[model samples]
Target: MDSLQPILNSIQKFQQQHSQILREASRVAMISNYIPDEAFRMAKATENLTRQLKIINSDSIQKAFDTISSIKLDLHLPSFPKFDYLEFDEQRLERITRHNVSVGWTLTGDMPINLYLRDEYLDMEHDEIDKIFIAFYEEDEYVQLKTLIKNVKNGLSEKWSEILDQSLDLYLEGRYKITIPALISVIEGELSSIIGSSKYGKRLVDEFHNKLDDKMKFLTIAAYSAYFFFDEHLFKSHDFTHARLPLLNRNWILHGRDDPSAWKKEDALRLLNTLSTLQFIKEIEIAEN
Candidate 1:
C-alpha cells in the first residue's frame, strides 16, 4: 500500500484540482480570439494583408460586401443571393489563406468569420473589404473588435448584450476559464434561438442541413462551423475522459470535464465570432419573415 502512495497522491491531486467540476457534473466554456506567439500571428495577419493589398473600385469583393451589409431581406429576397455572391481570384485567396492555415487559423465563415467577406490589400486603394478582413483576423487587442462591439452594442438583443459584453471582457483579460465556458453556453443558447428549435449539441448541426446553400460564401462559412462545433468528433460523439486533450471539445467543456489549460484565446474568439455570425443570420431571418 505504501508503494502506491505516490500514484494515489497524483490521482487525488488531479481530482482536487477539478473538484468544482465534479460538484457540478456540470458547467460550461471562446476567443475574444490564439497564443504561443499570438503577437506573431497578429503581426503576420496584418503583414499578410499587405501581400494582396489590391482592391478595385466596384470590384466584386466590394460590391458583395456593400450588398450584404445593407440588403433588406424582405425587399431584396430574390436579389439576396445575387448580392451575397462572391468569387475568389484563386491565387490571391490561396496566398491569404495558406499562411493562416499554417498557423491553425481558418476564417469562421458559414460560420463567416473569414476576412474574405466573399474572402484584402497593401498600398493600392483600400475599401470596406480590407477593413472587414482585418477585423476578422487581427489578434491585436487594439483592433476593430471594439468598433465591432460598439457598432453592434446598441443593436444586440438584451440577453446577448449581457453575455457577450461580459465574455469579451473576460477574454480580453485572459480569463479563458470563465470566458470559455460562458461563451460556449451562450453560443448554444443563441443557436437555439436562431434555428427556432430546441435542438442541442450535435442535434443542432442537423437543423442547419436544410438552411445551407453551399454556394453562398458567408452562409456556408458560418454554418459549416456551427456543425463543426458538434460534428466531426470534436465533442459529444466521443467518450469523456479527464486525460483527453482539450481542443475545443464542447461536450467536455459543458460537462465540466475539460481542462482550461487547453482552452486558448482561439476557442473564445472563434465562438464569439461564431456568435456574431449567428446573430447576423438571425437578423436576416427576422427581416425576411
Candidate 2:
C-alpha cells in the first residue's frame, strides 16, 4: 500500500509519448512518396516500431496490475485494447517488408495499419487509483507514528514498555478516552524514572537550570533583557505554579480526576513527543557518563 502515484504517473507519461510517436509513424507510412524504396523503408521501420511499442504497452499494463495486486486492495482495472489484431497486422507488415527489402521495393499495394491506442481506460480508472494512494498515505502516517513510539519505548526501561504499548494500542483502537490517560501515565513514568535515578536525581535538574541561566546571560543585552522579562513573568512563574497545582502538575490525570472527553489526540501526541525527548536526553547523559 505504499505510494503508487509515482509509478502510475510514469506509465501515463510513457504512454502519451509512445502514442505520439506511433501516430507520426502511421502518417509517414501512409504518405505516397515518389521514391518506391523510401516508402518500403518507412513501412519496415513503422512495423518494427509498432511491435516494440506493443511490447512496451503490454509490459506497462502488467506492471500496473502487479502494483495493484501487491497492495492487496481489491480494485478492478478496466479492459485494455486487444493486441491480437495489432499482432496479426504486424505479421502482415513483416511479410510485406521482407519481400520489398529483399527484391525490388514495391510501394503499390502498401497500406497504413491503424494502430489501436486508448487513453480513456486510464482516465476512467485514475480516480480509484488515486483513492488507493490516499489510503496508503494515511496508513504510512500511522506506521511512522508507531515506529516513533517503538523507538521511544526501546529507549525506556522494561517497566515503562507496558504503559507505552497500552497507550498506543488504545490510540490505534479508537479508545481515545482511555488512550489519553495511558499516555499521561507513560510521560509520568519516564519523568519519575529520570528524577528518581540515584546517579542523576534532582542534582541533574539543578545543574541543567544553572547551565540554562549561564547560556541565557551570554546573549546580547537586549536579548538577555527580553528573556529575563519572559523568565520572570512566564517561564519561572509557570514553573512555580505548575509545581504547586496538583492537577496542573499532572495530579488529576495521575489521580483520575481529569475528564477523558476533554483529552485530545494532539495532547496525547505532544506527551509522547515529550517522552521521546526525555529518552533522547537520557541517552545523551549515559553516553557522556
User: Tens-digit lDDT track for model 2 on 200-220?
Assistant: 323434444454365442222
Clashing pairs for model 2 are none
Q: Pick the candidate with the highest lDDT.
A: 1
TM-score of 2: 0.37
Q: For each candidate, what TM-score against the reference?
A: 0.52, 0.37
**Root mean square deviation (Cα) for candidate 2:** 27.1
- What lDDT does the true structure give each of the candidates? 0.46, 0.41
TM-score for candidate 1, please give it. 0.52
